[model samples]
Target: MSFGLVARAAGMFAVTNIDDILILALFFAQVRHRPRGVAIVVLGQYVGFAAILAAAVIGALGAGLLPESVLPYLGLLPMILGIRAGWKAWRERHDAADGDSPVGERSDVGILTVAAVTLANGGDNIGVYVPVFANSGTSAMVVYLVVFLALVAVWCAAGRFFATRPPVARALARWGHVLLPVVLIAIGMLILIEGGAFGL
Candidate 1:
């Protein structure tokens, strides 16, 4: 029974977080050269995912910490972050054109930035997890949480593996500045539309 529970948990996590692989890969591409970069990304992922699980657990326990309507507005967080990144990229381009050092040489994405993006991206995961958690017994919920947390490490490693691939690394080094902002904004817009935010 415990093994079954673990398998179920793993399946659910994989189903819900499949998109996270690409996002994590992009993050790894950005930070892989920095000191403690892998640790920072992993820590941010955990902080964000821990918040998601906390919300699910709370909802399962019948405590309404946030209203359903407010969930869609969570999409704004990513949109805002995307805009900030875009502006930074723009500035870097202009600086490079002007013969000044490129601001892109420095890392702008910190742990909180990664955490915010992760949390924003998991809005859908919360919707999926709440009912499953609410229906499960305490032991099942524990198993699910354990499996989910453990898989986060695997996800990070997979992301880093992809980011470090020769072709992928070269492409990212050339175009990641543009791609990151575009992806984040697209994700935010998708979340909003899917959530029916602004009647879209």
Candidate 2:
């Protein structure tokens, strides 16, 4: 077992946007109408992340699509994702009308909708995590999966907790579009910096 690899995976998990996972959980909470559905969504997200991590590791090692030396370029992905998220947030913030109830205004979110939104929001996090997975071997991958799932579970629980309250739920729904992107952008920038971009 490589302690360094485990540490890197944990570090990458920490700085990435765990909040969007919550937003996704909130969307699931709204759609399922049952509080337990949030758990289902959380499970799905872990499965999806595990698939992504496996792909990154296998593809990098087997096909060599991602060379170990090129891992630093993963930093650029977060920068781009950050800028894209900031742009989307700015657009939504400016486009919405006054007195518009954001979350309550659109309550008919479906499973596919939640999935698509979750995947879009996960871009930066995926980019950061992929590189880390590529650097590690089997044992590190297991550690990564465990830690990532645990953190995601915690975040989803928080989202579901707030989503159960009418007032808080409404507030989240309204500001979620505006807030989610901003948080993602901030996290993306941090990932870029930590991924060794400054030395450039």
Candidate 3:
């Protein structure tokens, strides 16, 4: 409710989660044509972020639901998902070349997949949020949660806007199958390196 509290919460979320916009944009691009794609993406984001917030809250309460070391291992989730997407794309390409059928416009990016990726990508967020939440009062924590959730919607809308731009959309639509796996793997590697996972 206090302006300072709101600002602090907003700043924390923005600083910690800025990378999410690009990831959401990529997801939006991949699923743009599906009737319920946007809804699914939003839902997936919420689900993932809810998990991150839960962890932070638990850590603030000194419960330590997951050890900090384990966060780096979460990076493996995205890497595996990337490999799976790449394999699927390869199979689809092979099928197309064999005249089995034209490759469909649809994507296999599902809500759970998006949620998993988001959660995996939020390792740094957990690290930052836990301490901040612990230092704050219950009311301040409520404000932070509200601001963070509100900004999630804002982030999703902004991502959709960028992804739907004519040029960007065309590029993504044309090469998204190839690009998605690369992006996912790169993000996973970045997370691992940042967290010093597997000794980098």
Most accurate candidate by lDDT: 3
Residue lDDT tens for model 3, 1-200? 79987986786676556556657877888887889999999999999999999998887767234577766555665576668767887877544233221112336878897788789878756755664565456888889999999999998997789765746544433465576566556656756786788898
Instruction: Report the C-alpha displacement of residue 50, candidate 1, in angstroms.
Output: 0.3
**Higher-lDDT candidate of 1 and 2:** 1
Using lDDT as the measure, what is the rank order of every candidate, best first? 3, 1, 2
Question: Clash pairs of candidate 3?
Answer: none
lDDT of 1 at 157: 90
- What residue runs in model 3 are displaced by over 4 Å at the alpha carbon? 63-106, 165-200
lDDT of 3 at 115: 86
User: What is the lDDT of every predicted structure here?
Assistant: 0.71, 0.57, 0.71
Q: Compute the lDDT of residue 84 as modeled in candidate 1.
A: 73
Q: What is the C-alpha RMSD of each candidate to the true structure, in Å?
A: 8.9, 5.1, 9.2
User: Candidate 2 on 1-200: residue-level lDDT in tens?
Assistant: 56775565565565564445336545655656665566556665665555555655564455235554566555455556657766875776644345343233447654454545555556556655554455455577678777766776666676667655656655544565555455545544654455565564
Model 3 weakest 10-residue run by lDDT: 96-105
Better of 1 and 3 by lDDT: 3
TM-score of each: 0.62, 0.60, 0.62
